[model samples]
Target: MKLLIYDHDGQLVELEDVSAKTLMLGIRDAGLNLTAQCGGCASCGTCHVYVDNAWQAKLKPPSELEDAMLDVVEERRESSRLSCQIELTKDLDGLTVTLAPGSAFE
Candidate 1:
């Protein structure tokens, strides 16, 4: 399984064989500076990312709680998702996401 993360500078970080980890964990492991203030508990929108439209359906639907958190993020888009809420799996191979501007590393 693999994932492509488009960072704030538009650099794409490729992750391979990253299974059983949340998207937030994958990003953190990649050395990007996304803020997961509440860890992977989805309590904060600090890990927000915009799912590439082509890969949106491949991810699990966000829960009500996640939707609420997303609402507070001014950069939220129709494709907005909390990385912490997304679990990496073989089915998510090739998943691509762009870091939402609001959640970009400072």
Candidate 2:
């Protein structure tokens, strides 16, 4: 699967994933600044990302828990999502997401 990530500065980086990890794990593995502190549990909201508008409708809506987590993020927007909630699959190949500011790296 191919994942395209836009960092805070808008630099685009392409990543490939053979392991079916969630988007959060893929970002962390790519050595980006995303700490993803809660792993894929969707609790800490550290994996916040903005799905590219063109790809937004392709993703499943956030779960109730994920929605709640997103609500508290200061940078939340219509495109904001918890990357941990999105498992990468063939369907998600070529997905693009931007690192949102609320992602708590520390």
**Candidate 1 runs further than 4 Å off:** none
What number of clashing residue pairs does each candidate have, in the order they appear? 0, 0
**For candidate 2, what is the TM-score?**
0.92
Q: What is the C-alpha RMSD of each candidate to the true structure, in Å?
A: 1.2, 1.4
Candidate 2 per-residue C-alpha lDDT over 11-57 given as tens digits, one digit per residue, 9 for 90 to 100: 99988654657888888888888968877898888889999999988
lDDT of 1 by residue, 2-101 (tens): 8898998898988777764888998887778787788899887899999998989888899999999999986789999999999987778889998888
| lDDT of all predictions | 0.87, 0.86
Which regions in candidate 2 have their CA more than 4 angstroms from the true location?
104-106
In lDDT terms, which candidate is top?
1
